[model samples]
Target chain A: MTGPDRPHSPSGDGTPAPRRSPWRPRSRQGRAGPLTYLVLIGVTVVSVFPLYWTLVAATRTNAEINSVPPPMLPGGNLMKNIDLAYDQIDLTKAILNSLIVSGSIAVGTVMFCTLAGFAFAKLRFRFNNLLFGLTLGTMMIPPSLGAIPLYMMMVELGWIDHLQAVVLPTLVSAFGVFFMRQYLVEALPNELLEAGWVDGASTFRVFRSIVLPIARPAMAVLGMLVFLQAWNDFFWPILALTANNPTVQVALNNLGQGYVPDRSVIMAGTFLTTIPVIAVFILLGRQIVGGIMQGAIKG
Target chain B: MFKARRRAGQGSAPYLFVAPFFLVFAAFGLFPILYTAWVSLHAVDLQNPNESTWVGLENYRKLFSSDFFWNALENTFTIGVISTVPQLCIALGIAHLLNYRLRGRTFFRVAMLMPYATSVAAATLVFSGLFGRDFGMINWLLGQVGVNPVDWDSGRWTSQNALSTIITWRWVGYNALIYLAGMQSVPADLYESAAIDGASRWQQFRYVTIPSLRPTILFTIVVSTIGAIQVFGEPLLFGGVSGHLGGAGRQYQTLGVLLYDEGWFNYKLGYAAAVAWTMFVIIVVAVLVNTTLARRRWRNAA
Candidate 1:
């Protein structure tokens, strides 16, 4: 973290000072001038406008969306659009399916990655660095490179339309392991594990009680990231899950591409699909931001 | 100094703890990739994959001569450069701005992540509507400026730009936040010293901040390059409703879309695997090149 004179650190007692030029370095509050705020606000509008547009369109009739100057405000047709989307597409089923797949992957990844991460961070084992490096290196291999054989394997196993086809393949995230290991190595002390071992607590017991409890905050961040990724995934879901078993993303795509594509209906479906991740983001904004930055900086 | 001895009980525990990943990764991650390489060398019919015949290098040979393959590679490079350059530049600027103590700091930071957290499928669907030729908001705005409405997804350059816009929109904020983190760690004292030496804001940023952020910049560029090359969902959605072919004339077909097309639609599993292998090679080479260039720059700066 930067010091008091740096940008983010608040001035003691939190009173607004006279406006200063952002170009001039301030020794006090370090607050940005008006110009900087103007630029940031503009950037935020551009960044957020599309989602706003989607919401506007989702709540409006098709004619309103197609108007020369599109309806800038949300309209009264939101429930109507939702009803049409629900009746035409299996919106509820797709959302439920997405929840199941994403939930399983998130929980599974957190548990598995944490266990391995604790071992790597705490225990002294043969080839520990080598194993950890291998895990890190695997991050470079994009899963898409194996699409053909994965589909074939799924076909061979008759898992083509099964949720596990999507879930099982993505459970072991290399980045998740790397991220958790880094956190654990920094957070949990060696003496704690040693104390548990000296007290004749089994390694599993120590990991279950001591490490897991302490590592909860790190796990929550990792779990949120993993869940968001699984929920937003498209290519694999489209390839694995057929029409009968569409995830929310797939279902939304189908709605968008249907024979008589209605913009409001599709937008309604898109809105429904996007809400969960956005809600998660809003709820855990600080943690998610920290998780992303920490992962990137460490890597 | 509390190093527990890895003797009787602890010896196998670490291995047991790590076994789940190895087991799952071998079966799912590593095995399938190796199997794909195996499949790349054979002429495999999707309908009857068991009857795959070894064709050793023929798929590669065909892939090299194929117009579609070359077109896809060209499109991928075109869009990757277009998207990557501006995405990083804009992200750098945004990070610079955010580094200052603005009012509503948390609100702006959280707002920056909104685009990143949205699903690609959903984002693309919204974007496609916006980029639509006739009644789109983009075209509507352009008309106000006395410009004709252009068909975005039809032409090669236009479609590529359209897809690049989608990629840039989704990733810019994420990258900006990363750069912001790097900026925060740049030792604020350096800026203080630079300012004391009577350096202007621009000069201080150019000389001090940029130099300090070299490693972070390199890190982001390499990762972005890899992600850009393997861009899938944007092009896939932009391609059309059903076809994995990038466009009517394969205009915006990236390497990812090409791989999917060859495998699923054409049932040319062997050739698709070749495409996948080729993409993997290109990414590895690109990463190597980026690291070497960045390291050389670091050396020169030092």
Candidate 2:
């Protein structure tokens, strides 16, 4: 198949056709008509408008934000509102807390999932299928079912208002293991392991040198996904931590639910919470897109 | 010597490698889920969780008899349908558009996914602001079209619709990309054959594309249904101050918010556990129903 990004040549091939056919089916697929572009542009606008409006609202004063036909354009109060939100809530601490929590969870999930996935995919062991099936089954079990007991456990452990309370429960996801296992099954060749075995390399050594290198791409993808999930996770974090110590999502929630409703300040807090992830998306979007598509095919 | 070393390594290496997951799952996952069942059978106060009185089936009975529980269930179902149906349909359309080779293909895909990158907290806050009863952009836009302003927060349908809109906005792009991946895998010759038979684009889409995308569509539907069943963050944040109650009249209280409200707000741990288990059963039933229906459809086709 031709690459999606390649432009459709008039002759419908890299080498010019001797003459164009009355109906060129192959190139026609590549040549989207005007209506298609119009629809796509419409969808794009709808997709982006809310985030854009968040920026607009964040820059305006509450009075301007609350005015009818609300300020479409940004006002000059961006920094002021941000400052107000910062003063009202410990946003900087929240961001730092989020980074630490998400970072640790991401690293932990990737490490544990890769190890488990490698074993599931390549190694032969007792109850291998049974164990792997259990892992997959766990994915179907909703996290909410465990909330009450987990909350009690957290309380018993004195982990309330602790970042670890939020981090530990989510440190290893069943989905991460499944994703890595799928990737490894396809990507890791058994011959490599056999070669290592023949070379007298222990399983751990082979894993460290050979498996890790081969699994790096999948690990990176899983890490990004887990980090995104950890960062955006609200339900557990809100339950575990209070306003005094909150992640970005928890802080944003507090800001939104503040007794004295300040729309602009809330929007400012929303903007602050969202921008870091958006910036990351902007930078690594292509890989993230690729990762999702790749996972879609396998999953 | 090497064979002996390899055998020794193989004997324990896999177990050691896989231990972390099992250990963590035992500690955090399996235990809690099982303990939730235990908790559900007892009346456990949030303040004194250790002290519990066994009230077998009482929480479930109370839930079955409670108006709020029923309201939340109804809200969850209605919101799930409204959100998932339109979201998937729009995603399929977007995917079709994306399949056609367009300039800035990467740009469009990445830009559309920005909402997915935005957290539920951020997205809900932004959407709630936009859907404000007064001075909101949506009402302003509707006013331009001679439509009356909508009290998006108060009314049952409006509030649910607003919550669903937030869900749709966040997920449509992600689902579109999933569908696009499926679309890309459809053999080009099918489309070519259809075109040669003088099929129009709409006909091609109707006959060729949708059939080819059955598994992908089913996958999205199941996934979306699972997500919708657990709809919490959007409704909770959308409620603003009384976030846990969903709305003043419980207009849009999803099962997830109900769980939170019962446990966190009302401090009824036993009742929340019942809600949680009920949700679990509902999800399992939903998955089974989907699977059975899909299998039956496939059998019929066969």
Best by lDDT: 2
Q: Which residue ranges in model 2 land beyond 4 Å of their true spot?
A: A1-23, B1-9
Q: What's the fnat for candidate 2, on a 0 to 1 scale?
A: 0.71
Q: For candidate 2, what is the interface RMSD? A: 3.6
| Model 2 residue A213 CA deviation in Å | 1.4
Off by over 4 Å in 1: A1-30, B1-9
**Chain B TM-score (model 1 vs. true structure):** 0.94
Per-residue lDDT of candidate 1, residues A94-204 (tens digit): 999999999999999999999899888888788788999998888877787777888888888899889999999999888889888877887887889878888878899
Model-by-model lDDT, in order?
0.84, 0.86
Error of 1 at A195 (Å): 1.4
Score every model by TM-score.
Answer: 0.93, 0.94
DockQ of each: 0.53, 0.54
